[model samples]
Structures are given as C-alpha cells and as structure tokens.
Target: MSFTIAIIGRPNVGKSTLFNRLVGQKLALVDDMPGVTRDRREGEAKLHDLSFTIIDTAGLDEGPKGSLTARMQEQTETAIALADALFFVIDARIGLTPADRAFADFARRADKPVLLLANKSEGKHGELGAMESYALGLGDPIQISAEHGEGMGELYDAVSKLVPPTEDEDEEHEETDEERAARPIRVAIVGRPNAGKSTLINHLLGEERLLTSPEAGTTRDSIAVEIEYKGRGFRIFDTAGLRRRSRIEEKLEKLSVADALRAVRFAEVVVLMMDAQNRFEEQDLRIADLIEREGRALVIAVNKWDLMEAQPGQIAGLRRDADHWLPQVAGAPIVAVSGLMGEGIDRLMQAIVQSYAVWNRRVPTAALNRWFEGAIANNPPPAVSGRRLKLNYITQTKARPPSFVLFCSRADAIPQSYLRYLVNSMRETFELPGTPVRITLREKANPFAHKRKRPN
Candidate 1:
C-alpha cells in the first residue's frame, strides 16, 4: 500500500510550504497570516526514491462552531484521521505557542506515527527553536527551512524511516506499454499580470525556480511542470498573463497572449487567477467565458489577498460578485489567497482537487437519460421546421468538463438558444458550477421504423 503523510501545525508554521516542497510545485498558497488554510489538501510527494501521498492540513485553532477557525480545525482533524503518519510542523523562528501544544496533544491522541518538524531553521537564530521542539514529546525534531530548502536530506531520511520499503511495490507499479500510453491531466494556470501566478508556482516548487518581477508581462512563454499528486502524475502548465487585445502594442506581448490561449485549449482544468483588488474584471469574466466555451474545467482563484483588508463580509461579497458577473460559472469555488504571503494556499489546493474530481465526474448513462427525459418533459426542445425536435438518447462521451453526445432528430436544425438552455439545465442539475459542459447533437437515422422505399 502507498504510504500517506500528513503535514500538521499551527497557522503560519509553513505546513503548506513544506507540502509544496515535497510535492515539487507551488501548489499551495503561502502567507504570513494565521488561519489562511482552511482545508485538507492532498498531493503525491516524492523524496529521493521514496514516493508517498502527502496531505497538507489547515492549522489548528479553537473557536466557536461553524466559524472559519473551527472549520479549519475540523478539517485538520479529518486529515489526522486519514493519515498513516503525521509531520507536525512548527515555525523555528517563532517557537511554539499554546495552540501548538494543544495540537500536539491532539496528534498524540490520534496514535499515528508523528514526526516533529522545526521549519524555517535556516540559521543560528532558528537553532534554539529547533532545540525547543523536543519539549513536544514527539521525539527528535527535524530542522529545515521550507522556503530556502535547507536540511532536506534529514527530512528525507526521517520520512523514509517512517514509511516501509516499497521495492516490491515499485516493481508491481512499473507500467507496461499499454499503461504508459494513458493520458495525463492537462492543467493550465492563466491570470492577469502580477496576480501571483509565478509566486504561486514558486511556492509549489519550494524554491525561487520561477523568475518573478513586479513588472507586468514578466512571463513571455508557457512553462510546463510535471509532478505527482495522490500517487498519480499530473502535468501543470503555467502560462503568460493574458492582456486585452487593445493593449497588445508589442509583438512579444501579442505572441505571449496567443501562447496563453493555446495553453487553455490544451488544458483539461483551466485555473483562472484574479487579483483580489480587481476580482471580477471584464477581462477576468472574458477569460472564464473563453474557458467555458472551450469545454475545459474551470477553477477561479483570488490572489494577493494579503494586501487587502479582509472583513467578515469580504468572502461573501466576492461570492455574490462572482455569481452576479459570472453566472455561467456559478458555484465555482473561489479561494482567497495571498500568493506572496502564502495564505489560503491549502484551501486553494483542496478546491483544485475537488474541482478536478467534479471535472472527471461521469454520470451513468441510465441516470443521465432519466435526467434528460425529465428535462425534456419540463421544457421541450424548440420546434424546428414545424416539427418538435426529438432528443432520443444521451451518453457521456468524455469527462474533464463532462461532454455528452445526444442522438436526436434534425440535429442541424437545433437552435443555439435551445442548446444554451440544455447546457444551463445540465449545469444546474449536475451541480457542475464554474466548469464547462459540452453537448453534441447528432441526427439519428431510423432503420427498422422506416418503410422500404421503392428501389432507389
């Protein structure tokens, strides 16, 4: 069986940062603020030759029921229950607090193998804090700086010891010729300039691997990074910031935008990043609509939230704005994050995984046809050539923005407005928000039902 490790800690302790380090991508958001992560994010991780599943959990906190803090804690608890081992992270620069102690106790009660980590241990200043980690009673501490990538060897050793040898498992998992031909998840990250797209990537890689600048249009080409998640490999494409056509004065900028659009077409999941200050700009909506039109799974992320003054109403307000402006993508999970500060990174990742799950969701043909029948019963297809269009059968042809092919009569005569209605109805009925749904109408020829014509 594949080993599973959970990264647990208090807020701002670099749990998500360490997660990205292990997963080899800036898949998680990092920020200085506490309680930024409010969900459990899972990814495939590898250290040296060791491979395992990694769960990045929200920082633990005590609060009233249904509150964000409480919900985060609950999510962490869920991670604790699911993990085979736990990596309890603490900030070496800040030392431990009562909250950390409380969470340590919680982890102890879970009875799973636990590794204490003193993260951010880059210099002598962090040494004292690393030494102090012994008090947690979780055994010797592994000191490392997730941001600078210091002391990764010790982390690899510690994790290797906790996980059983996978030599035989590896042999069993070696892919045959047919297995190697399987398609991989195609992901593209598109956003406006300086929306933390590169920062987010750097965070995932746990290194300053991407060139980041304050200037707009810094990235000129699409970069592809392949990594594993949940024991499966995924290909993530980071594309250049898309600017409006009117602003494309430079040839290089025009090329970059075209390249970004091409990336969108190739992606199965198109993650659209938005600057928190300009959450739902016309350009943002346009990008989302374009993704939908291309039949790609969509996930919206709000970046650079550290600079914003967030209130209790901020998330609600953003949700309302998304619904009002991008109704086609309604119910799309909008994760608030500060890519620079790393806040809300875990939640963002969880949302990605969830959206991916939905994108790959396939409804049974029987159930789908039943729903189709009900939809047709509720609102019949528009009349064409003085005859009502007959939609006979529907079958899901593909997923990753679930696509269906409908066998019907007079497919060529079907109106675009009616197709839009069907698409909207499917979206609402299937709870597929923020992602595209494709339906192809094909005319069916009757064989047995038709009378034999005079020999033609």
Candidate 2:
C-alpha cells in the first residue's frame, strides 16, 4: 500500500458502508445499529487508479475506563496513530452532534491531512447538513453518499491530492507456485464463547492487537492479523465465538457468526479452541465437525491449560478424547495452551504449520494405487444386497484437503462406511494424519456403452 487512511466517526454515520464500497467488497459488516464495528479492520482500497490501505474503525464514543466501549475507542485511536490521513465521517441527514464536534478536534489534534466526509449526502437534506459541517474547522466537507455512491468522483479527487505521487514502476511479475507456497499460511482461530481465541492470537502477535474480554462474543468481526513464528509467516484470524444455534438471539450475533464462518472457509488451517475445563463438549464437537465438513485442516488447542493440574497422561487423554469426539478429523494434533501466559504457543504454531502441510499433501499416482490395492486387500468393500463390489482403482484428484476419486463397478452400492475405511486406511498408509480426506466414488466409464451396438 502506498499510504494508509483511517475512517473515524460517530456511530451509525455509514463509515462501514463507505469502507465496503472503497474496498469493492462487503468486508465490513454494516447495520443500522450504532457501533457494529469494534476492532479496526483494514482492507486494500482502490479508487480509479489510486490504491492504498484503508482502515474501518469503531464509532468514536466516550465510556468508562476499562469498559468494552473504552477499549473500542482505544482501537480507533490506534488506527489514527497508524494512518497517514484521516476520513472524519459525519451523518449528513442527521447533522453534526456533540460527537462530530468532539472527534473533529481529535482528528485535528492528530495533525494529519483530514477529509471531512458528510456521509448519507444524496439529497437536499444532505446538502444542508454538509453546509452545517463547515463550522467544525475541518475544512469544506465532501458530500458523498456512502450507500448510493453519489459523490465518489469528489472523494477520489480529495483523496488523490493527499497521496504522494510515485514514479511509474516496472511491470508486475506473475506469481510463481513456489512463491505462492512461501506466502503466509492463512489460519483461523475459532471456537465456543470465551475460549481464548483472541488471547492466543494476541500472544502470537506479542501485542494487544485484538480485543479480548471475559464477555462472550466480544469480537463481532473476523479480524485478521499477520505474524511470523520462527522463520515462517502466517495470517491468523481472530473470530467471534460460536454458540449453539438455539442460543443465537441477536441479529448482530448472527452476522458475527456468518463472518466467522467466512473466515474459516478462506483459511488454509483452522484451530479449534476449547476451554480446558469443558474440553470436548457438544458445542466444541459441533464446531470441529463444521471445520471438517468445510474440508479445512484442523488443529485443536485446549486453552486455559495453566489452570489444569499437571497430571501424567493428561496429554494422551486429550488426544484420545479428541479422536473419540471428532473421528472425522482423527489423528489431528491437539495442543494444551495458555494464551494468557503464552504457554504452548510455539507448539500450537508448529501444529498449525504441520497441519497445513498435510492438508496440501499429495501422493504420486504410483504410490496412491499401491496404497489402494493394499487397503482393498486388508478390508475389501463388503457386498451390498448379495452383489459383489468390484473396486478397480483410485487416484488423487486434488489436495488442499486431499480429495480423491475411486473408480468402481457400482458407485452407489459402495457404502459410506466402506469409503470411511478407505479414507482412514489411506491416511495411515500415506501418513496423512488430521487433514480431511475425501474419496468420491465414480463408476468406470464403459467405452462400448457410449457407442451404439452393431444391430442389437
């Protein structure tokens, strides 16, 4: 990114709506309610020819010290400190409130180039409010309706002036497979309410980069941050806690759950956080099942391990329980961690990297067929309805969850239990532990069946 810009404003001023439009994606959750966004979320913004990093911050509001609102304000302040420019957004339809006046001074105190944006500026009401904003001393307000994108041209002109010009660069190079492989591994930390997901990410980042609290579902957005462990780089996401479906009541929480699920789908590896006191609970199993169903690599992190007694064989017990609870992701690595104290952080990271590698693992065709034969020999696909099942062979179709296609005489006749056996066997043979292995049954194409017979 050439320059960083932060969008700061009072609640329900359409800051997030503007952020989604600038980023060309609905990356930020937008709602009519105030303070839908808490943590500062960043995205690459492109306006015509200009490209830069844009941050969406929480609503600027005053609250008691150490409260969630206060922490959110702290997040906004941090974004301001890191930005080269500020977009002071105000509701044009509603006109300036005390918050707009207060935060206008806050933005001015930052001493950066400020662009006063009168959001919701789409009509005569907007024009009146934009005219009212001139008293804030933040210069002429740019009237732009974030929802309808009415004055994007004006927004572009103002933003372009603040960004410094750079010499035309060389042509961009195409990314190679090796370079892609070496890029940061995307990992999402997900789990039930207050399972230390944010705490673990904060420890890895070695800073208070993400908001953490005893309050369940404190994180409303899927916040991603980059970190380097040892020599490898990773993009880790701190997501909102997921509760049982019956328990979700609020509309905002539902949106938060959807955002977290989106993060999981985008990630290469997902770490399922579990409270040590309540490990392998029904909800934890459900989450693990969801991760497996999504076909992402799984790593179980038993959090708050420091509070547990140092009993011998406790690690083995956890392993046994994990396999028993989540057989779909059997052999997945389980690490006991204390995110608050940073214990087992290194091991957790190692497990993540290892699981990612396994998820993308592929076996050569020769080796794969050999394993298929041996697996069939050990426990053949059982007969269904007294008809013998002819298993021809199997080939790996893809990786990144390691999918396969098995050619057989009767595709439908092959029971799911048999496929499960084959998957487990392949995992054991190829050392593909933990990652979800998919085997799709297909009937071998009969060449003559496609063509017309002689005269029959």
Candidate 3:
C-alpha cells in the first residue's frame, strides 16, 4: 500500500523545490519565474524508511480562475482528498499573507492532516516570517529550507507519524512469488519515426487512442498504456521515434529524444521495433546500444513482416545478419511480426515475460560461488607482475540486471578481459543470454591477518 502526499502553496513558495527534495530528484521543472508549473507532476518519494508518492501541484492563485487554473486547483484538491497527509508550504522570506490564510482555511475544511512548512528559512531575515507561520492556526510550523535541504529529518518524522504502518498480512502478501510476478512489467517500444510503434500499440490495445499516420514523428511524448495480456498486467510505454542526434534541428525533437531516453531508463524491458525493409540502421543500433548500456532486457520485433517480399532463405539471411551485426545482444529473441495483422503477438508477449524474468533473476550465494569456482577452474585468471591473482569468492550484490562482486587477492591487477570472460561464463551457465551482466572485482579484506601480534 502506497501513500501520497501533496505539496500545496502559492507561486514561488518552493513547492516544486520541496517536491523535488522529497522525491530525491529534479523531476519537476523549477525556475525563478512564477507559474512555471502548469501541470500536476508526480514522483516516487522516500523519507527515511517510508516510501510514498509525492505530487507537485501548480501554484494556487486568486482570480475568476481561468480553465487552466481551475483545472490545476481541481487537481490539487483531488490530491489533497486522496493523500494521507499534506504539506502546506509558505515562503518564510515573505512571511504570512491573506492568500496563505485563505489556503489554510481551505486545508482545515478538508479535515486532513496538514504539516505546515515555513520554506526558505535559511537566513536570519526569515526568522520573523517563520514565527509568523503560527498565526495560520495550523499548529506549529516546521522551519525548512527546501532549496538548502534543511529540516528533512523533522519532515520525515511528521510524515511517518501521519501514515500508519502496513498490516502484517499486507507485508506477508507482498513476499509471495505470485505477488512479485503480478507487478506490471514496464516495456518500452522504441524505434525510428513511422516505424509502426504507435500502430503496434494501437493494434495491441485494439483501439485508436494513439494518433497513427504515415507522417514521421507524430508522437512527441512518451505515453504509457496499461493492458492485461493473458491475465498478466503490462505497462507498455510508447516513446517517440528517435532520430539521429545530428539530424535533430527542432527544439521539440530534442525534447522528444530526452523523453525517449527517460522512458528507456524507467522501463525494465525494451522492445526494439524495426521496419523489415530498413532494419539495422545506424540509429537503430544506437538505440539498441542505449538499451544495452542501461542493462535492460531486450527483445527485437521486426515489424511490417507482411509487406516484405522475400525469396527462399530470406528469413535465414536476416537471422544471420542479426547474429553477426548485433553480437553484443547475442541470442536475443527476435520475432518477425506484422503489427498491422497482429501476427506473433502471443510469442512476443511470452518473450517479453521471459526476458523480464531473466532481468529480475537472483542467483544464490552458494550457487554463484560454485559457478565462479568452475569458471576459474576452466580458465584461470592470468598471472600479473609475476604474481598469480587469487579470486576467493563471488557474490551478487544487486539484482535488477544482476550485478556481482568478486572478492580477489588483487582487484587492481585484474584485467577487463578476465572480467568479460567471467561475465560471459556466467551468462552461458545461467542461461542469461541477451542480458547485460555486471561483475566488479574487489580485494578481499583480512582484518585478523592485518592485526599486529602482541608479545608478552
């Protein structure tokens, strides 16, 4: 169960600043100009041991309230109603005002737990304004410098107190494998413009929510759509078709590229869609390399397969080309599908689920050590500077793409080639093809051996 917290205040009170602070990222655009944020941006937030959702709302203002402002206010109010707690922020440098009082009354009427924050309280000049926050009748104000990151401990305490602990059943329920598998698999469809990305999504969803045409670059934003396939939930992200950076002249195209990169970062698996006629372009390789660099699971879908006029052994020729050109993602599952005709959709989904499972796999410590020993036995680590390097043990330190740390006698002397050998061996042994594996070599610490002996 996740809780949401809304940051509400007038313009330039550091509401966006505080939202970024709580979320631990600059996800929301922050500028000195008033009314910079027009939309309600949300992010995952963590405070101490608690993790929740944080919403950055547009600055509340007074007017006959135009449609945009009214919509912003409605979004803020919706967040307030849904949130377990709210952070009512005010600029301490400017002190309290009638507008602040008006909003305080609005929060009071809502009957929700409100944490009054006196933001911009970094200097002595803001002391009086911080003291003035008490007049809002929202209880004692927590002095904070959202920009400077002061008083976060108190904020964490306040939020944790407001949101109750998770029930034991809920905690246990999350531990089940079914629960783990039930999480929506984040999948990103990436390719060049007019490469049938939007068409593919529209076909999968059996709707026309996405605008599709022969024109290139029709979709500028990365749009996420949720669908259940065979009773499994999948969150598919349709990203803008990324063109070569040198060719991107328009400002919107630049933004679109950034958005596509962001989508790649957020996705667990990337489905690289390509036109069968124009497959394996330089830009396509660049996109595939980006996915590989991000250590994401990958599945290549050759779209427009129905339109391809092929002779005998054409499909075999294409497979050989893929094997030779994309050796980094060797053995990646490639499905020749016509998104227009909905061919191979089921096989594509199965490949996606399988790739996602491989991406999230965890190798036990004992099994990992055994594999490491076997690998070393098969191909020993090379001797360096007349010294044979001894690799003691290997253990996985992290999992979302499976990272391991190898404790060795001399980590600095280990060459990159040896590391690659170990990684390749692990990939083959664990059947983790087409997925990037990270192996870090570290010198083992020997505390007892380093201590000096005491002579009586």
lDDT of the candidates, in the order given: 0.80, 0.91, 0.83
- Worst 10-residue lDDT window, candidate 1: 164-173
Q: Using lDDT as the measure, what is the rank order of every candidate, best first?
A: 2, 3, 1
Candidate 3 segments whose C-alpha is farther than 4 A from its true place: 1-177, 312-318, 446-456
1-456 per-residue lDDT for model 1 (tens digits): 478888988888998789889999765556665654554667889887888989887777788976655656776787788789999999988887887888899889999999999998988879988988888899999999998888899988888888764554534556775574354567788988777787887677665544566877666556666656555556777777887779878665665677778889988778889998887888898898898788777888899888888578888888898889887777888888877888887787667767777888888878788888998999898887689888888899988778899999888988888878887888788877777777888879888667877796
Clashes of 3: 0
Considering every candidate listed, which one attains the maximal lDDT?
2
**Which scores better on lDDT, 1 or 3?**
3
Candidate 3, residue 176: CA error in Å?
Answer: 5.6
Q: Which candidate model has the greater lDDT, 1 or 2?
A: 2
lDDT of 2 by residue, 170-240 (tens): 89889999898889999999999999999888888888888889988889899989888898999999999
- What shift in Å separates residue 218 of candidate 2 from its native position after superposition? 0.7
Off by over 4 Å in 1: 1-185, 226-234, 384-386, 446-456
For model 1, what is the C-alpha lDDT against the true structure? 0.80
After superposing all C-alphas onto the true structure, candidate 2 shows an RMSD in angstroms of 1.9
Give lDDT: candidate 1, residue 323: 83
